[model samples]
Target: MIVETFNKEKRNSKTVELVCDLGITGGGTAGVCAAITAARKGTKVVLIQDRPVLGGNASSEVRLWILGATSHMGNNNRWSREGGVIDEILVENLYRNPEGNAVIFDTVLLEKVLNEENITLLLNTSVYDVTKSGDTKIESLKAFNPQNSTEYIVKAPLFCDASGDGIVAFKAGASFRMGAEPKEEFGELFAPDKSYGELLGHSMYFYSKNTDKPVKFKAPEFALKDIKQIPRYKAIGKDDKGCRFWWFEYGGRHDTIHDTEHIKYELWKVIYGVWDYIKNSGEFDDVDNMTLEWVGTIPGKRESRRFEGLYMMTQQDVINQQQFDDVIAHGGWAIDLHPADGVYSKLSACTQWHSKGVYQIPYRSFVSKDIDNLFLAGRIISATHVAFGSTRVMATTGLCAQAVGMAAALCTEKGMNPADILKNRSIETLQNELNIVGQSIPNIPINSKSNLISEAAMEVSSELEISEIPFDGDWFRLNISAAQLLPFKANQNYNFQLLVKADEATELEIQLRTSEKSKNYTPELILEKQTFSLNEGEQHINVEFLKGTPNNQYAFVSFLSNDKVSLKTSDKRYSGILSVFNGVNKAVSNNGKQVPPTDIGVDEFEFWTPHRRPDGKNIAMKIYPAIQSFGSDNIGNGYVRPWGEVNAWVADLNDKNPSLKVEWDEVKKVSEIKLFLDPDYDHPMESTLMGHPEEVVPFCMRNYKIKDLDGNMLHSVEGNYQTINVFKPEKPLNLKGFIVEAEHPSEDVPAAIFEILCQ
Candidate 1:
């Protein structure tokens, strides 16, 4: 290398220009999903991220767990996991990095983006300037990367702003709000007042490791000396690390965007001081071997600038579970808001109010009101401050961003603006495109007109007629009330027999309950209650309900808690079957039930949540007059996942070779076939810190093969663990029918499929 001679004047940085179909600012989960979805739709995308990694708050630098409607399986939302590319990412992460290492998760996000040919990822690049076309649309963006000392000018027809602070939109003169609105502004009764704080704050977390030998820690001069300043300092323990310190926050009282550095420094002081206390406070035992392993350099920001769009989501929209004609996304995370003073305030750190079910997010909330070619995404989407509390979570925002990405692709193909896609019948086209890729919209069925499978006749080897759950697993004590969720039809008398062992003679009360809403699993409406006297030894107890169900929905066969009784649990697991408990999951519900204050404008209901794998076994029981809901015809029902009913067709456990045959009247040219399999939507599959029990969900199909009418094998797959599997033959085949042969993931678990589509 040759050194250049000193010049009288400094030289400017090198400039580069790029052109693409879609340009996205921010590489958070939202931006990442937008990039992936748009790329898959044949749109050229340029993703610019200021951070070195892709996941934003979910990245290694921040290390926050990715959660969505399922809310870590702590709420009543059943099968409510966000679908589409975000679901694929979470499922893949669970299969590959079940331990949830933050660094490993970073690799997963990077690999997904890299695998897409149409995505051009530009990391460590920050957009600082925007060039406007006539003051209504963005013509191009000016960005810089200090690492490479290069300036970038990116031009695209359409742009999406998923950056947490709305950097691009802000520079482009797009309207935005940064603080809470008055109650009268949106009729939000739960809106916070001035004393309670308007904006949420930033948080920082650190990880610790235990060494076999003793370790020493010394605080720096700038470290906080008085740990008692934090009211909840006593809650910290040897195991308190990572997201457990999510409440280690500050800086809501100041500017969240411009004062980020000042906030980060204060967080560091708090972290170092807490570490120093853990090592030297002499208030606990056996912490001498603990040492600080990693500390976050940047703070995870919660609230920032929210851009205004055509429609602004309000508090009533979330609390009422409002539906929209142009619904594109859904969110179920509670209306969680933090105190303005953050860790310093004694006001419980955060307040969360949950709705009865998931709410729909409309496409109108994604298009910028002023910028013709700009789309809003992530936490920056148009939403009142009250509603933003729920939509700001990583998974929810990522899902909304997926809609933005798909809209961008549609805009590029049709040569229209973001707002035009919502006009005429184009919104339906957008929804259909999203559903084709596995995006679950509330109350919206997959109505793809090109799915030729809907015109064919289907026959299966055997359909599972659920009559019994054999006593083949462990005996779980009735320390907490437990219930088995069973799908039932209307006007059908139900009788259940459960095997239980009682320490002493006791009266076991069994209640049949169902949710007021068909699609929910809250178990609020009690249908029938029966009391049965049990003997001292193992015995079978029978309970009969002649009233039956009011509608076709899931009924809970609830066994109230009895310390003297233990119920047998079955190892058998099904796609839409689960056993829930009337217990508290402090993460979502403070108590076993949510009994909110009278004026909070939130519903009060009991949280019936399921336990994770290897623990939440189904209650061993037998039902009279077996329920026949699973049939081969369900494969073309247009629903991809369980909504108010079991939309999947499950094969009988006894059927050794389960196969499905789809036949048509005449041979048709087919090029693509898509199969929707069971991936256990109830599981949250948190991306980091919270490790999963299994690499693959128990309901996933392990192996499968496809064949034509002439018995020629088209494609075969082994060890499949994904939700949606696609098979494309080498060339289009003229076939009158096709057969699918699948192997169950396990012997006890039957093979189940949601839908099959052919084109």
Candidate 2:
């Protein structure tokens, strides 16, 4: 039920019910990315998120310099500048904070909100409840802020839960999984048996400018008394980068939930104790200007909950670099594991080799198994302990946010669920969009038609294990759920159980049906919707949607709760849908096609009108009369076509008789003027720009008041073809190059692109 709504007309407005469009939760990495993604797609959106500041970990809060995909020439950056909004923020940060320090990021986040008019930001707020009618749709969501104690009931057809913890999804009845599976299951060399729940530890980030500076302080009584019990107590004299750091830490067993407060209490003690040790040991005799400037208020947790999504990704999928039409992202980091006690444990399973390789993360990782509206990002995405180790990096998580954001916006524009988008429409659109932003979804073929997952592909053999996957090959490129490719042996096959989860719990029944009904086996599995007493953090869980059967379609995954959550899921979600490749099915390149070209036509009339400024306001524009002969061979059409001159004119309340006559001399205030020549009329010959006179420059057109009735003038600018930026007149302008600013922006930040002084 889509209603139409627009900005009401001033005081005298008409009653119009606009359909709620898009709703987003969280203002962190994923949340902001999703909002920008949707807004870029021309969707009007309401971006609701917690925290007054954005850029969760990559922000001033944690003060971690963002690491791109891969560093070129060992610089630690992989040309990830294509993420339009994200890069825009980074560039702005560099300008405002030339040093790009972690203490300030206000300028970065604010620039995006101001640039995109389609996005409405609701910061310092959290989504409390999600309302949904059934599996197919969302009604509205309720939000709350301590300052504004009043809970806001925001209504939007499309809702994106980018909260790192998957809170909305958990509240919406999403299903999820956790811990590591047995090595025999996924056959991932790193996976271990049983669920230790010991995951990657959280980081209490801090920045120190001087390493040689030392200060005097007393050790804490508690740490000194309990120093013997602290695990891995050996002081790491140097970190990975050779800085004197401490791998010596603990918190999980104590209380990871209240980590911030606990860390502050313990860190202060450690700081004093360290000074005493160094001072007493005479390591720092005469050091100065060095101090723990600040420590993170909040510890960035690497792992917590794992949602059960449509498909569970695994290390095998990554190891093989399996090609999937539904590939949402790619990760190259090894599975990094943290000890259960928030300390560096010896029980690790990450291999450094994978860092240089490419692996595909399918689109299934976005949604929760049971939670309907919820999506997730950061280290908390859906993956087994080992797999999570690989996918839990900031780079991949950012990609995940981008994927879900596009899907959520699509759900709003097209009255359908996100899963439906994957089931019905082509996944290629999402991939292409990501590519446009310069993300590398390596599996995306060149110009393929529809990038979608295969219907149903069971391993079929108990002995079908594959080890080495091609990083840039096409023949063996395939897309299968992590469950379908797990427990890899030289030869073996593994089946999967269809499951689901959601924000709230409700009765969800599932059944496997044959494509034609003439089947010897088909039974429905009536799954009971199980609800958990979800807390305010991340809680989305993943569940299998189907048992071991075939011919499954429309597997439902949803929750039942507007304020809390509700969900429904079926085992058999889809079957038998093949993706259409551009020319040859897989990625066999259409460039091989032979061409038969003949004579092309000429004097073609291409009618097109430039849209008004994207800022939603019209510009102060003017049109000039074309002083041309009756019939000239529009010879060099490399000029801006002039309006008037034997052309039809449309005006707003000015004249009954319009003419295309120009004065003998009119100063040219406006440089370029465009006209629309529809082919529906006669296709005229080439238009011309004619002039002949010593000082009578016929090319200079007149300035005839380019204004609206209300009298507003627009600043007209011409951008350089190379760099798509409007050239500022007073400042040096160049389209050829741009500045590669620091990680953050500031008022005195130097430009990344060199300036081109226009003579």
Candidate 3:
């Protein structure tokens, strides 16, 4: 090969120009989702990431678990997991890597993006410059990949900045806020004061493993010499690894964006110093065989710049559970804020206050107010400092970014801007598109315009009639108050009979409670209360609520804690049915009840949460006039997930081959059908670090097939573990009706489906 050299000139790196329909920066959960969502809609997308891997904080580099509305299942937001592409990723991760190996998770994300033919992924590329078509519209972006020594000029009509710090928006001169607003500014009572710190900080984590033999460690000179310098040093132990060190934070008081390296160094010093104390300081025994297996070089950032959009979400929107007409997404993570002083300060690591239920996120909050073609996504979306505390979580931000993706696709198709879509009342069109892909918007039902099943006659092989949860020879101690959440129709009287054993003669308290808001799981309104006298032996106790339920919602049949009594639990598990406890989760709640100051403007209530499987069994009880919420008609009910009611169609436990048939008066051409199955939305499928107990959710259909009227198989799927299953024949099928047959994933759990759509 011959090499030619230029004389008296400075040569630039190789430059490549690419044009796409949608351009997204930062390949975190949000960017990954945005790219995938837009690509699936037939839009050409370019995904840019400065890091080698995707998932941002959830990547193996940083290794923070992906959590959203479910809030680690520590709050009352039941069945509130974020849906669409993120749900698919988390569910796939659980099936492929239940142990939650972060490296394996990286493969899952890469595989997902690679599977899409329309997405062009550019990794290790950093955006440094922006070219604008006008003062308010970005024309192109200039990014360089240091690893390849290449320069890229990416041009697109629409641009989304999910880059954590809003790099593109900032470079394009989009309006942004970097610090907290005062209390009087937005009337946010929970807004932090100047003394309390206005921003959350960066955190780093390290993992340790036993080497089977003694290992030696030496601290560098830069390592912190004194472990006592950390205020919470006493809380550290041999088992303190991974996210347990989330409190090992710093630099909130500093410029989070420009001073990230400084903050990272401080965190590293603290980490190494803590390790030194554990290895050489003799604070922990049997640690000689332990060694640091991995240390995150890049820190997981919590807060920085927030771009302003057409609408700014405030604390009131979250606390009041505001419903927006242009709703695009939902959030249920508590208003979690960390102290700015981080590990150095004596203040608690974080302050979290949960709302009664999930809140809607409007599409207006994702479009730039100044930039005509720009979209703000991820933690940088248009939410005030107070509201950002809850919306900043990865999964919540990912869902918001998904809305941006769909909006971009719509904007590209209609030749309109993001604001025009809202002004023209086209948000419903956007919402319907998202719902088609399995994204759950609060209070938004699946659109029936394209679903032919809505016009068909539906019949199921068998329906579950909830009459009893028979005793399975398992006894549960009444060490803590517990309640069974049961669905009831409006103006329906309910009678319950519970089996309990008493240690001695005592008074057992039973109460019927429900949330003031039907869609919420919080049990705050007590409709009826009764005190029953129990003898010294096992007996049946009857409690009746003659007033009946005020609305069609889940009512909590509550039994207060009494050490002298033990209740019976059943092994039978059903969809949309759960037993909750009035106790502390410690991770998300400090005590069993939240009694905040009156001036804080947040509600004070007790946390009623469900325990993880292998322990959270339903209470053994019988009800008069069994509730029939799981009817055959529910398959076309428009609602996909359980809202105020059990919107799923569950089959009887005795049906060996469960099936649903949708028949039309005349033959109709069907190109595709989508099935919305249950994937245990209540389970917080953390993408990393936290391991799952099952490879597939027990309530999901493991095997299913679609058949025509002549009993000919059209399609079949095995080992399915996803929430949304799409069945498309090689060619369009013309038929009068079709049958969907499915097998229960587990013998103990019955077959259930939320909604089915045919086109």
Worst 10 residues of 1 by lDDT: 583-592
lDDT string for model 3 (271-316, tens) is 8888888899976889989998999999999999998998999999
Off by over 4 Å in 1: 1-10
Error of 3 at 38 (Å): 0.5
Q: Mind giving the per-residue lDDT tens digits that candidate 2 earns over 1-759?
A: 987678586543232222346777777666677787778778787777677677766666654444333311111011222233443444345434544445456545656765788887777777777777787356777777666555577777667766666666666676655456666776666564333344444454444335654554444575343333344444423111111122333443443433546754564454445444443544543435454455556555555567777777876775455667788666654445555554434443222223223467888777665655555555556778777876765545666777777777667666666677576545766666665443445534223221111111111001111121111211111111001111111111222222223334433322221111111101122233333344332233333332322222211122222333222211110011011111211111112121212221111111111111111011111111111111111111211111111111211112222112111132223222222111110010000111111111111111222221233432332211121122223433222211111110112111111111111
Give per-model TM-scores.
0.99, 0.53, 0.99
State the C-alpha lDDT per candidate.
0.91, 0.41, 0.91
Give Cα distance to truth, residue 11, candidate 3, Å.
0.3
Model 3 error, position 472 (Å)? 1.4
lDDT, candidate 1, equals 0.91
lDDT of 2 at 319: 49
| Backbone clashes counted, model 1 | 0
Candidate 1, pairs of clashing residues:
none
After TM-score superposition, the amount by which residue 32's alpha carbon in candidate 2 deviates from its true location, in angstroms, is 1.4
What TM-score should be assigned to candidate 3?
0.99
In the range 532-610, model 1's lDDT, one tens digit per residue, is: 8999999988878977777888889999999999999998988888899988888875467888888868888888889
